[model samples]
Target chain A: MSISDSTILSVQDVSISYLAHRGKVRAVSRVSFDLHQGESLALIGESGCGKSTLNLGIIRLLPKTGRIDQGKILYTTRDGRVVDVLGLSEREMREFRWAECAMVFQAALNSLNPVIRVRDMVYDTAQAHGRHDRVQIRKRMLELFRRVRLDPERVFNAYPHELSGGMRQRVLLALGVLLNPQVVILDEPTTAVDILTQRTILEVLRELRAAMGFSIIFISHDLSIAAEMADTVATMYAGEIVEIGPVEELFYRPRHAYTLGLLEAVPKLSVGAQELVSIPGSPPDLIEPPPGCKFHPRCPFVTERCRREPPPLVEEAPGHRVACFESARVLAHSQPVR
Target chain B: MEATTSPQAVQSGWAAFWKATRRALTGYTARTLLQGLLTIWAVMTFTFVLIRQMPSNPVQIEAERIVREELVSYEEAYSRAASLFDFDPNQPIIEQYVEYLAKLIRLDFGQSITSAGTPVLDQILQYLPWTVFSVGLGLLISFTIGIFVGMAMAYWRGGILDNVVTALASILFGIPNYIIALLIILILGVQLKLFSVAEALGRVDPTIEPGFTPEYIGSVLSHAILPVVTYVSATVGGWILTMKSSTIATLGEEYVTVAQARGLSQWRVLTAYVGRNAMLPLVTRLAISIGFVVGGSVIIEDIYRYRGLGKFLTTAIVARDYTSMQGVFLVIAVSVVVANMLADVLYGALDPRVRVGKEQ
Candidate 1:
C-alpha cells in the first residue's frame, strides 16, 4: 500500500482552523492522504465537511482568519524534491503554486473578471508568473481552447459575462491547466454548471489530465460524481476523513458506519425509493464539535466507545481505511446501497 | 449582430468603416448622448421657470434710486421700472416666461436690472472659472487619496490603521464643508496666521493687473487654498468609506481567490483584480463629483470672502439680479447633465462588460 511510481504529494495530519466570529472553528482536522501522480482522489462529503478546506489548504489559499494549525503538507516538486509546503516562505510558495499545482475553483464561472476578456484573464495569470513571451503564451492558449472544444477567436476577445456558463467553466478549466501543472485541485468545478456543461467539463478535464498526466484532488459533495470521476475516495465527516479507500472498496464494502449511512442516503437510479435512509442530523457544529468521534452525536450506530475517544483511521482491508469503533459490526450488517 | 468574420470581407476597409459608423450612430454612445441632452434641456427649462418665481426687489430698487437721486416723480419711476424688464405688469406670469424663453434662445439674458447695464453673461464668465478651479482641484485630491486610503484599510481591515481611518472618515462625513471652512479660516486665518484673512479673499489682490503673469496666477491659487481644502476634507470621507466597503466585498469574491491561486503576486492581484472590480461604482461617482465643481462651494466662498460664482449668486439674490441668477442656475444644471453623460461614455473605456456593441 506504500506510494510508488506516481506519488506526487502527501497531506500528513494537516489541521486547519478558522477564526470565525463565534469562535475558532476547526475546518480541517489532522487529515492525511497520499496523492499519486496522475491519479484522481475524490474528497466527498456533505456540505461544510472540510472537503473544500482540504483543497484550499493544499494550495494555501485559506482566507484571512484561516490558519494551518498543525502538520506538514509535503509537496513533491516537479523535479522530485519533497518540500514542506507549510515551511516554505510566501515567496517560495508563489513559485510552487501554479507552476506545480493549480485549482479550478468552485462556482467560479460567475467570478471571472466581468470586465476582462476571457483571453486576457488567462494571459494575466500566465504573465503574473513571469511568462513574458506573448506569442508563445497566445499560441498555447489557443491550443488549450481547442483542447477544451472551444473556439479561441469567438470567445477569447469577449468579456466573461458575454459567455454562457458552460463556456465560462471551460475557460476556467483552461486556466487551471494552463501550465500543465503536475497537480490540479478542482473544488466543485461543476457546482453551478448545467448537466450538459458538467459532462463537457468532466470530459475535457479527463482528456487533459490523461494527456498531461497530472494528479488531481477533486473535491465535491456529490457522491455519484465522485464515484464516477475518482480513483480513490475519501469520505469526510465533522472535518475528518472518516473513511478512505478505492472507490469500489468504499462504495461496495464501506467499513465505516458514517460511510454506510452516507451510501444508504443516496437515491439510486432505475429503482424507486422505499426507505432511502438519511443521515439523522446536519453536519456537526464546527465551532463546538462533539467530543471523541466528532460524528458520534449524529452517528447511527453510536456506542460508548464512539463517545469516549476518537477512533484513529486504521486500515481494515488491503487498501481501505475506516475510523469507526463498530466498523466491523456495521460492515457485516449494512447492505450495499449502490 | 456582427456575424461576418471572414477575413476577406474585412480586408476592403468598407466593412470596417460601416461598422464604425454604425457603432457611433446606433450604439450606447449615441443613445447616452441623446439622454444627456434631454436631461440638460429639462433642467434648464425647470430652472428658468423657478428663478423667475424667486422674490426679486429689482423694480423697487430702481424706482427708489430714480426718486432719491434723479428727483423723478413716483409715476415716472414706476413706468421706467416696468419698461426696463420689457414686461407689462398686467401680463400673466406664463406670458413673461415665454418672452424670457425667446430672449434666452437669442443668447440675451437682459442686463442685470439691479446693477444697471452690466451684462449677466459677462459677470458669469468672470466668476465661473474661479469656482471650477477650486472645486475641481479639491475633488481630484480627495478622490485619489480617499480611494488609496480606503483600499489600504480594506487590505488591513481589522488592524489599528483601519480603525483610525474609519474614525477619520466618520468625522469628515459628520461635519459639513462650510463648517470645516469656517474652522479653517477661524484657526488658520485668525490664530495661526498661516494665511491672511484679507489676502486669501477675492479672486486676486486688487493691486495686481489682471494679466497672464506668474504673479497674478500665484495670487489666484493662494485665494483658492482654504476653500479647496475645506471642500476636499468634507467630501473625502464618503469616498473612503464607500471604497473600503466595496473593496472588502470584492476581496471575498471567488475571482480574487482564483486570482491569488494562479500564483499572481499580491500586488498584481490587489490592483488588477480586486482594486479594478471595486472601483467601477466609484468611477461613475467620480464623474458626478467633477460635475459639482460647477455648482461651487457657496458657503465656503462666503466664509473666505472669495469672488466665485457661488458668491456672485448670493449677491445677485440680495440685489435682485434676475438675469444673473438665471444664467448661473442654467450653467450649473447644464454642467451636471454633461458630467453624467461623460460618465456613461467613460464606462466604455473603463469596464469592458458595459461596452456591448449594439442594443438588442
Candidate 2:
C-alpha cells in the first residue's frame, strides 16, 4: 500500500446473496475495496457482475430479498469517529444517509420530484440535514447551479419534467453534494446522457471533487471512461474482484487474462478497424457459478491447476494485484511496446 | 410536418376516431350494449313467467279475499278484482305478452292490485327519493372515510396503525350488511336512545303536515341517520381494503422510489406521487360504488324497514304483484344504466387517458 492517507471508507470482505426463486443467488462474493479521501475508485463490470449490487449493499439499500451474508462497511463520520453502517437502525440510517453520504442515481431525470421545482428538491436536503438557513440555502443552491454550469434562474424554478436529461443530471449532482458530505456514490451517472454531455458532466464531477474534496465511488461498466476518471480501478467478474490496481498500472500492465481481454475489447479510435473486437461467451450464472476459478472456462490460458482450485488475489507489484495463477507467464508472453 | 387542410385528411382523421371507438366497444363483444339488452329482456321475460306460474292465481286470490274480507257478494268482488288487476282469465298467454310489450313501450306499468289500486310507476317514483337520500349519503360518507384512512394506512405500512386498520376492515367486511344494520339498531336505537329506528319514508312525518319547516327537516334528517350509518358501516371496509392495496402497489413503483431518492419529504412523495397514481384504480371502484348506491341495499333497507326500492321489491315478491314487481325492476334497471353512464362520463373527465366523444 502507498499509505498516502488513511482509508476514508473501508469495505471488508463483503458478501451479499438474494433468495431467488431457483435458489440462492450470490450477488457480491467477498468483494473488498477502500475509498481514500478525495480520490475516485471505479468498480467496472458487465451487468450482473455485482457492481450495482455491491454499491447497494455498501449503502444498506438492498431490496427485501437481498441480505448481507457477510461483510462490514465502516465509514469515518464527521465527528472524527468510524462506525459500521449495517449496525444502524432504519431511523438512524435515514438520518445519516443523505447527511453524511449521498448518492446520485443512474436515471437522474426520473429521480427528481416532478411536481416540485428544482429549488424545493435541493432545499429539502438542506432542511433535512439542518445545514443552513433559508437565505443561506438559496445562496448555496445558486452557487451550486453556477458551479455545475447551469443557468440558476431558468433551472431553479423549473420542474424536473421541464428540464432535459443532462440538466436533470446536473440538478441531481447538485443535490448529492449540497451537504458537502465526505463521500458520494455516483452509480452510472453518465449512462443516460449524450456523449458531449457525458464529457461535460465528467469534467464537472472532476472540478467538484477538486474544490469540495469529497471522495467518490464511481460505478460503471464503461472501462474507458472509468480509466479516464478513476485513480484506482477494481475489475469484477462473477461478483469477485479479478484485478485491482492503479488505473495506469492496470491499463499498461494487466496480468489477468480476463483483464487483458477487457482492455483489448475497448475499441481504440487511433486504430483503423472495420469492426470492434468483442469478448466471446457470456457471464457465468451467479446462482451456480462454475467450479474452481469461475473464469477458467472462459480463459484462453486455462490449465489443470486453474480448473482445480481458485487463485486468490496476489500482489504482483506495488499497488498491482491479479487473481490468476499464470500472471507471471501472461506478462512474460506479451509483445514488447513500440 | 406541414399542416394538412385537405379534405382527405379530415375524412381520414374522422375515420380513425370512429374506428377506435368501434374497436373499443366491440372488442369485448360479449359485454357490448346489445348483448346486455338481450340479457335484460331474457331476465324480464323469465320474471314474468315465474310470477304467473305461481300457485293461487292473482285474479282468484283477489276475488276470494275481497269477498271474505269485505263481506261482499262474489259477483261484486269478481268485478272489482278484474278491474284492479286488468285481468280476464279467458285471455290467452300469447295475447297477454303482446299486451304486456305494448304497455311496456307506452311506459304504462299498470296498477298495483296489492296496494289498494295505486299505480305501480307512481309507487316507485314515490319511494325513489328516500332510497337516493339514504344510500347516496351513506356512500359519500363511506368513500370519504375509506380513501383517507386507506391512504394513512398505506403511508405507515407494516406499522401498528396499518395492522389495526387492516384488522378492523377485515372484520367489518366479513359481517353481512343486515347483521351490521341489526347490530346498529340494537346499539344506537335501543340502548343509546338516539334517532328513530323505523319510519324511513316520506322524508318527513305525515302527521307533521307536508310543509317544509326546521322541525320537520330535523326530524327527517334524524330519522335518516340510523340507516345511513348502518349502510356506511357495512360498505366502507371494502373501499378501504381496495384503496389500501392499490396505494401500496403504487408506492412500490419505480417513480415513487425515484421521488424519494430525489430527497423529497415523506409527505411530499406520498401525496404527490403515490397518492395521485394510486387514486386511478380507486376512482373506477368509486364509480361502481356510485352505481350501486342508486340501486339501494336490498338487505339493509329491509332490516331498517325503510320503504326504499329494495323493500318495495321484497313486498312485491311476497304479494305476487306482477305489475308492482315489473315497475320496481324497470326503475332499478334505468337507475343502474343511468348511474353507470354518469360514472363513465366522470371517469373520462377525471382521467385524461380516457377519450370521449369517439363513439355515437
Candidate 3:
C-alpha cells in the first residue's frame, strides 16, 4: 500500500453518497489515494464526476445531503499522530478544520463576508486561534495581502463589493492560508477571473506554495490548469479515479481511454487544425447506474468482457494506475515517442 | 481681460469645486429626492380631487341632519347650512382647486365641519401622536422579534421548531388585524379577565387628565395592551416569513460556504454572513413599513376607539367632513413618500454596492 512516515493525508477507500431527490447518488465510490507531504495532488475531472464531492469530503464540509458512507480521512497531525478526522466531535472538527487543512472555495468573489471589512474578518479568524496581539495580526494581514499580490491599503478597509472579482479571489486566498494550515483545497479558484488575473493568481499560489510548504488538492475541470499546478494527477470519471499517475506520464502516455479522449479534447495551438475530439454520451444516472464497467458504454474500444465485468484499478507501472480492460492493447497501439 | 492668464489653475479650481458639489448631490440622490417630492404632490392632489368629488357636500349633509334632528323648516335649515358651511360649492372647480392649493402651500387644511369647528390641521396634530406612539412601538417590537426568530427558524429549517414557528406566524398573518384584536379582547380581556375589557376600549381612563405623569402613562399603556397586540399579530407574520425565506436563500449562497470554510463558528456564519446579508431587504421593508404604518393605524384605532388620527379620520368620514378627510390623507401620503425617501438613503448607506454602482 506504500504506507509511509511522511504521508500528510490519505483517503483510504473513502466513499460518499448524496441523498438526492431521486434517491441515493453514489458520488464518490471507494476512492483510495495517498497524498505525501508537500506534494500537490490535483483531482482533475469533468463536472459531476465527484471531484468536488471528494474534495469536500476530505474537510468534512459536505453539504447536508452528502455523507461519508465508509472509509476514513486519515490526517497525520503535527505531533506524528494519524487521526481519523471524522471521529472528531463537532468541536474537535471545528478546531481541526482551517488549523489543519483549510479550503479555498470555488466561489471566491462571494466567499468573503460582504458587510465586514476584509481586515476585521481576517483579524477575527486570527484572534479565534489565540493570535490576540492586534499589532501582529495587522502585520500578518498586510504581509498576506502582499503575498497574494493585493494592495493592503485599499483592500483592507474596503468591503467585498468595492473590490474586483480577481481582487476578491486573492482576498479569499489570503484568508484561507492566513493561518498557514497544512493543506488548502482550491476548488476551481481561477474560474471566475480573467485570463491575465488567472495567470497572476496561479503565480501567487505557486509562490505561496513554495514559501508556506502546504500541500494542495487543486480541483479543476481544466486539464491544462491541473497539469500546470499539480505534481501528481488523479483523473476521475463517473465518481471514481479511473486513472492516476505523475503529470508528465498521465499527459503524454494515458492508459485510460477517457483520459486520452480528454487530452484530445483540449484545442492545441501547436497541432494547427487538428480538430478537438469530444467524447460522446452523458454520464449514467447515479441512482440507476449500469452494471459492469461504468465507462464501458462510452469507451472507444468497448469489448464484450468490458461490458460484462467492471475493470478494477490496476497499477500498470510504478505509481501509475489504469482501470480498463482494453488499456494494454490500446496502449500498445497508441505508443509513440513524443 | 487677462487673456494670457494661466487658465489651467483657474479652471482646475472651478472644476474641483464642481466635482465636489456633484459628489455631494449626485444625480441618483437628486433624482430620488425629486421623485419623493413628486410622489407627495401627486398623492395630495389625488386626495383633494377625490374628497371634493364625494356624493354628499358639507352643506347638504348638514341641512339634512338638522332637518332630521331639530325643529327647523327646510328654509331655516338651508339658510343655516349656507351660513355655517361657508365653503361655496357653486364656485368653479378650478377656482376652488387654486384656493385649495394656496391653502395647501400655507399648510392650512381648512376647518372641521363636525367637531367644535376646529381647524383640520389642529385636529390632525392632536390625534397623530397617539397613533404614532402606539403603532410605531408595536412595529418596532414585532420587527425585532420577527427578525431574530425568523432567522432562527431559517437556521433550523425543516425541523420541528421551524414548523412550529412557521405555523404560528402563518396564523397570525392570515387573520385580519381587527379580528386578531377581537380575539385578544375575547381571550385576554373578557375570557381570562386578565385586563379590564372596559379599560382596553380607550386610549386612557376618561377620569384621568391627559398628562405625562406616571399614573396617566400607566393608564395609556394598559389601554394600549389589546390594540398593540392586534397590531403585532397582524404584521409580525409577514416579517418572519420574509426574513426566513431571505435567510434560507442566503444560507445556500457560496459566500456562506466560504465563511464556513474560513472556520467560522455556526453562530458567526449564520448571524454575520447569513443574517446580516438577509437583513438588508428587511431594512428597506421596515422603513417603508414605518411610513405606511400611519395608514395601518386607521383600523386599529377604530377598533380600540382610541383618539388617534385614524379614529379621527374615520369620524370625519362618517360625518362627511371632507376637509378633515383631505387633511388626514394628505398627511398619510406625505409620510409614506418621506419614509420611502429615508429607506432609499438608508439602503445606499448600508450597501456600498448600491452606492458605488449608481456612481459609476
Candidate 4:
C-alpha cells in the first residue's frame, strides 16, 4: 500500500506453487512486499518455508514444476518505465535478467561453470546483453572483483575450480553486480564458507552495497546475519509473512508468537548458559496445511480463535505488521529489557 | 683432485644420479607409457603362443586340402605343400619363436607362410589403410550425429524427440555390428536393390586409380559405404545414450541454471555450459574407440567383402599363416595401448581438476 516513486520493486500478492504427484504444494501464499532503492530486505525463516521459492518467482526462474500462479512483480527501469516482469516476453525477460535484476544463488561453489574461465563467463554475460566491448567488460569486471576484495587479475583469468569457496562466492557477487543492475537477490551467500570467510563476505557485501547503491532481497535462515545485513526483516512461517517490520522494531518489539519464539530460540551471548527456548514441532506441510492460523499448533499463546480462523496480516504499528491473534500478549513477552 | 673429492662426495653424486633416474622411471607419463608397451608385448606374446596351439599347422592343413581335392597320395601332397610354402614346418617351435622375436625386434614381421614371398608387414600396411578409412569415417560420422541428437534429446527431455530417440537408440545399441552389416546388405542391397552388392565389394573400383581425383574418391566412398554404415549403426547408439545421460546430468548442475540466470542465449548455454561439460566423459570413450579403428570389425569386413586389415586378418587365420596373424594382432595391441594413453592425456586436458602431474 506504501507505493512511492523511490520503490524499485513492488511484489503484490504473489502466490507460487509446485506440482507434485500427491497435489499442488502451495509454497508461497499471497506474499507481498516493497523493496525501495538501496534498501536491503531480509526474508528470514526455517527451511521449507518458501523463502527461496518466492525469490525464484520474482526472476521467473522457477523450476519446470513451479508456477507463479498469481502475482505482479512491477519493476522500475532506470529510464523511469515500470514493467510488469510477469508480462515480459521470453526475449525481453532474458534481456531484463542480470541487466535489470540479478540473483546470487545459494550454491556459490557450484554457481560457476567449472570448465570455463571467470573472464569468459563475464564476457558471456556481457555478450548475451549485446555488449561486445570485451576490453571494457574485462576492465569493469576486474574493478568489481577488486571491490569484492579478490585478487582481480588472478581470479579473472582463473577457472572456478582454481578459486577457493569464499573467493568463488565473492566472484559470483562481483559478477552479479557487473551489469550494475537496480536489484540484486542474494540467497544465503555466506552459508558455504567458514566463519572467517563469512565475516569477510559480509564486510565485502556491505562495502559493495554502499558503493553500487542497489536494492537487495537477502534470504537467510541465520537471524544474526539477517539482523546485521537487513534494514527490514520479514519472518516467514508456513509460506506466509508472519511478521514484517523495521529490523530494530521486529527484534525489540516482536508482535507475533513465531517471531518472539525465533528470537528466544537463538542462543544469546549476554545471557551466557541460559537454557535456550525452542519452538516445538516442525513446520506444517504446505500440501495440506492445518486449518486456521498455521503457527497455532506450535504457538505458545494459542487460543480457540487462533485455531478456528487464520489471522490476516494487519498493521500493529505505523510500519510493523503481524498476522497473529495474540499480538498484544506476544509484544508484552518479547521485551527482554528489565 | 682425488683428495679434494672425498669418497663420500663421489658416493653422494652417484646416489643423486640414481635418484634422478628413479624419478624419471616412476614419473606418471613415463610410467603410463611403460605400462602400455608392456601390455602390447604381453598381448603379442599370448596371441603368438595361442595361435600355434591350433589343431593343424599351415603345411599339414594345405597338404590335406590338396589331397582331398586332387586325389593325390599323402606323401605327394605333403611335398607339393612344402614346395608351395615359404615356411619350414620341420623347424622346432622354440627356434621359430626365437627367430620371430629376433626379427620383430628389428620391426620385421617376416614372410607370410601361405602367401609365398610377401612380407607380413607389407601386406598389413596395404590392408591397414582401407580399414582406417572406413572405420574412421564411420566413427566420425557416428560421433557427430550422436552428440547432436543426444544433446537435443536431453535438452528437450520427455518430449517426443526424447521418447522416440531413447527407444530407437536403445534398440540400435543392442544390435551387433556384423548383424547390422548383414541387415544392410540384405534389406538395402539385395532385397531393396538400392545398390549392387557386387559393386560394393572390395575397397575401390579396379579401373580407377587410387588417388585424390573425384572419380577415384567417389569409387572409394561408394565401396566403403556398406561397411561404414554397419560401423555407424552398431556404435552410434552407445554414443547417443552416453551423451544423452551425460548432458542430462550436466543440465541438472547448478552452474547450468546459473548460466541461464546470467541471461546467456540458449545456444550459448547448450554449447559452452551443457555441451562442453557433458562431452568431458565422452572424450576418453572416443579415444578408446579410435584405438579399435585399427583392429576394425573382422566379420563386418568379411560380410561386405571389404579388403581391410580385418579381411587380411580373416584370410591369415583361415590359411593358418602364423606370421601374418601375429603381425595383425600386434598392430591391434599397439593401437589399443596407445589409445588408452591418449585417453588419459585427453581427459587431463579437458578437465583441469584432474590435469596430469599437478596433484601429488
* iRMS per model in Å: 1.3, 4.2, 1.5, 0.7
For B1-360, candidate 2 gives per-residue lDDT tens digits of 346567778899999999988877776432446655665666667777777887766677788889999999989998888787655666787787788878888888888867756888888888877888889999889988988989888878878989998999999989988888877778876788665555543345667755578877787787677779877888889889988999988776755665555445567667777787677777777776766774567777777677787788887777677778877776666556556655666666655446445444
Q: In candidate 4, which residue pairs clash?
A: none
Per candidate, the number of residue pairs that clash is 1, 0, 0, 0
Query: Over the stretch A127-169, how does candidate 4's per-residue lDDT look in tens digits?
Result: 9999999999999999999898999999999989999999999
lDDT of 2 at A49: 91
Regions more than 4 Å wrong, model 3: A1-3, B1-26, B164-168, B182-196, B212-214, B356-360
Regarding lDDT, does 1 or 4 come out ahead? 4
In order of lDDT, best first, we have 4, 3, 1, 2
**What lDDT does each candidate get?**
0.83, 0.78, 0.85, 0.91
Q: Which ten residues in a row have the lowest lDDT in candidate 1 chain B?
A: B82-91
lDDT string for model 3 (A211-249, tens) is 999999998888888999999999898899999999988
Better of 3 and 4 by TM-score: 4
- Please list, in the order the candidates appear, how each scores on TM-score for chain B only: 0.83, 0.78, 0.88, 0.96
All candidates: DockQ: 0.60, 0.17, 0.56, 0.80
Residue pairs with backbone overlap in model 3: none
What lDDT tens digits, residue by residue, belong to model 3 across residues B95-115? 877887898888888877666
Q: What is the DockQ of candidate 3?
A: 0.56
